[model samples]
Target chain A: MRYVLGLDGGGSKLLCVIADETGRMIGSSLAGPTNSSYNTPEEIELSITSVISEILANHNIARQDVSIVYGALPADGQLSISTITKNLHDGVKVNLCGEYVLSLFGAIQEDYGAVVQAGTGSFAHIRTPKTEITVGGWGPILGDEGSGYYIGKNALMACVRMADELGIFTILQERILTYCKQVKMRDLCTLIYATPSNKQSTLIASLCPIVGKAAAEGDKVAIDILEDAAEMLFMQASSVLKLPDVEARFPLTVAGGVWKTNPLLFNCFSTKIKQLFPQIDLRYPLFEPVIGGVLLGLRDLGFPVKAKIEELKHHFSAYSISADLFQ
Target chain B: MRYVLGLDGGGSKLLCVIADETGRMIGSSLAGPTNSSYNTPEEIELSITSVISEILANHNIARQDVSIVYGALPADGQLSISTITKNLHDGVKVNLCGEYVLSLFGAIQEDYGAVVQAGTGSFAHIRTPKTEITVGGWGPILGDEGSGYYIGKNALMACVRMADELGIFTILQERILTYCKQVKMRDLCTLIYATPSNKQSTLIASLCPIVGKAAAEGDKVAIDILEDAAEMLFMQASSVLKLPDVEARFPLTVAGGVWKTNPLLFNCFSTKIKQLFPQIDLRYPLFEPVIGGVLLGLRDLGFPVKAKIEELKHHFSAYSISADLFQ
Candidate 1:
């Protein structure tokens, strides 16, 4: 019974799933960030090796027993990838894929479609039979419009505008002060600017949930912010739909914690996209990205991927209950 | 001579003008940044003392003979002001004014009007007969719409969007690459993010001129960016104008390096503003902020401030020929 391992990661954490050739779940493990772009090579290597080792040990299996290892990470901003498999078992057949491909494979399952991810950062990936392209993943500063960072930063901007008396009054002013545990909102600048540059994106993006809370509470400012963010993200999806090669009814899915955590944002985004492309098949991802990694390995072995995916998800439904997928 | 001194400064530099009680120009000195919020109190004190010392020494005037010392610094982020005059002459009355007041007095000269400063950051100040108010001076993070930093950042955003193939292509993509000495527009992220947070605003705002260049050459993306920035800032000025106490034909002036460096942005903003508030008296600044400090000193010494402002500008025009005012 050959076993395959699937690894999916970002700048913050990694999730791994190990399964048999038949796609029966064998074991799994989690580890720290392994992003090649943001994390040092040393850090990436340590995360990959330790997690693989932990899973092998946990399932009472040897590293050499694995049939294949496949991993996916964010493709944007990557400067170099070097010697990642130096410590892995020989001939284990390790392959690394871009996060967009991982997400696409997980959701569309080799079909021609588009995937939009809106986690801490945001980007859109469109996959045609012959071509694949990503858009708007310019991180926090250059792009990431309608991502967590964008929504969170807009919430802060609204509060200060209210403070400046030029903006309509928003409850976010008091909410932010309460959330930040400060008398004034200006103290937030110190808290945000003092953070290290590498972590500042996450620090700012973390405010998304608070904004989500405000919108849920029916705060107009928060609602406006969420809707504006929805519009921005929709623009990326719209841009993809406008590609000459894409079919009129091409499939598109919105993924990431941002969509799941905020009903208002999700509903707003969905309404806008559906309004523009009425005939398009808009979808929520059917399988998480880690599952996509596993399916890639299954496809390499020439197995009937659709059957194996269903079987693995059926056997692992309770196990996949972790919030790991949403984040 | 019972000389009076006026000092106006920001996070980047300090400009000082020394004059007799009648506002006859004596000597002047330029020094490093003395912003109390971003700079160390020690640095502020050092800058103030050294600049004052330089002017007194240059003109062979005794520090003890100085009658009054008035300075204006940005009021938005100031945590506190320590003793900035400990090194100066004993019994010298050192009064500090908010930058808004300095700009206000410099332009309106104690009249009821509004002053908007659009330097590296953006903010608006209104002076009524009864009270004073500042709007939208929330620094780079919270506000500063249509500021140098805002326009510069928007230009970068447009370039990356074009690279993503989702935005209209603009010459700015090539211009930014050449400006930063990079092969691709993405390299700009590295150049910008690598700078320290304290200086990042200025570095990003520095891109304002390149954006101005593109707009002058008729890049639609660049033109759109400048126009959007103009709209955002116009909202701030419009908000101030809407106040119940402000007159139908209130006096207003636009001040800052941004206004002088970019003629296209100026015209776009001016046209939009004039179209909306046709009755408004929109004037360019009559005197620079440091001279505003001089006017403040003149007003304190029972001098006719309008005459003194005119006299000082006439006599100092040869020296103000320095791009120091534009910057």
Candidate 2:
């Protein structure tokens, strides 16, 4: 049987799955961060290849046996997808597809749909089954208007303010300061500016929940900051949602730590979304988005997926069922 | 004739003067930061040598004939008069005296008196024409409770707070962030924590007048921040004023940019000083503190400074003089 591969590259971790033409996911592997944001192109290639190679070896599948590979990865500068594809194709052979193509393909079982991604970066992509319309994912420099990084960044600013006035010091600043190992405000400022990566900032942002917790406890200041963050996110989401030809039931989903952990943020996002687009059908993703990769791989190889989705689900059902696997 | 060299080192700049044994000024130079808080010992030495070498060369003065080189520097970390003496003596021949000795020598002129130094770093020093006691000047970390760096640091923090959302966007953030070229709040937060040097912060703090202007235009938050900064300075001056042996009518002089530029701060400091030590005679320094260094150098050589002060003043009276040169 013809086989297909799906890869989901992330900043913190990478996931890959091998599925049959009939939609049965037969093998899988997990590894370190594959997002080019975390690793260089060469490093990303090595990481992606290692996971793909291991899964192929375990499943006794030769490179030629795989008909297609669909991968969704955060963009790394430009031609990042092609660079990754070239690396993957160097040893593991397959017809490699584009990043957004796979992410969109996974979201809709159809050959064409839209997916607004909000993970380490944020972007919106629309496909009429052939061409894709993409907007805004400039990685906090030019864009990323409202993402976890934005929320996390603003939360830090809040903590810094409170700390300066000896205003009710929250656990967020204490934890972030401890994590950063900066006792004085000056050292903290230096490290944040001098350090090359936004990685530590992301970690700092992961503490946005503390801001939420404070807001939940009726901190007017915290509430105001989070509300402002929500407003920025809403404005960006609206701009993407109203783009030309995005269908009424456009698949608008958030995939990031900020939205997942902060229920109030989710409520805020949902309320804003409803106010903007009443007909939008929002669905909690049924499978880890890597499954979108599997489905896209099947579609890319011209394989039927409706009946195969059942078999693919049954095969990965064991891994997905463990719930603790995510933990 | 023996030449006496006086060095006034503070947060912003170093002022050095060369005077004859009779306290008659010969040549002088102004250089960038000499406080150890600004650079490493090696850098400080290099900077000092560059200025000192220039002065000695310009005046055709032999290094060995310069009887004593006394400096009043921000006493922080490992910077002490003895440390400076060893550093200068490493390549040059001269007697090096402590920072406080230079201040006391500059202020009282008679080898006895107290001086409150509030520059990049702050401290109070008293000399009984014999024994000396100093309070504060613990750098920006342990002490410097009411120094310009302290006030400036607090002001930058207020800017960070206003940027995060009091729903009030003030000009302070724009100025600071533009200078720093930092867009993200996290970058601002990190830069604030990383203590670059008291000199760097002092430079940033030089922008406080801009913040004050913003306050005058009715930025309640900015006004409140300046008020708090003034109170801190008031307390710091009070801390120095309370030294046990420092008697009433002991000349209390305010030296430093903050004391000169910030009228509100000066008013608050003056009001508090009078309230706490009514009998303490306030002396508006007749010259810049670096001249006090010149006075110190002459006095150390056993010059009758009381009579020579008149001679030096008559010769250099037309020149904008630093009283600190004598003390």
Candidate 2 lDDT tens digits, A263-320: 5665676787788788776544335567777776766567676656556557666433
Q: Write candidate 1's Cα lDDT for A201-312 as tens digits.
A: 7876777888888888988898999899888888888887777788777888877778766778768778987787887888667677787788788788777877655665
The lDDT for every candidate, in the order shown, is 0.76, 0.60
The regions of model 2 sitting more than 4 angstroms off are A10-14, A30-42, A72-145, A169-198, A209-225, A242-247, A279-283, A287-289, A304-327, B1-52, B55-76, B79-87, B90-327
Residue A96 of candidate 2: its Cα lDDT? 44
Could you give the CAPRI-style class of model 1? medium
Q: What lDDT is reached at residue A224 by model 1?
A: 94
Q: Per-prediction DockQ scores?
A: 0.50, 0.06
- For each candidate, give its TM-score against the true structure: 0.86, 0.55
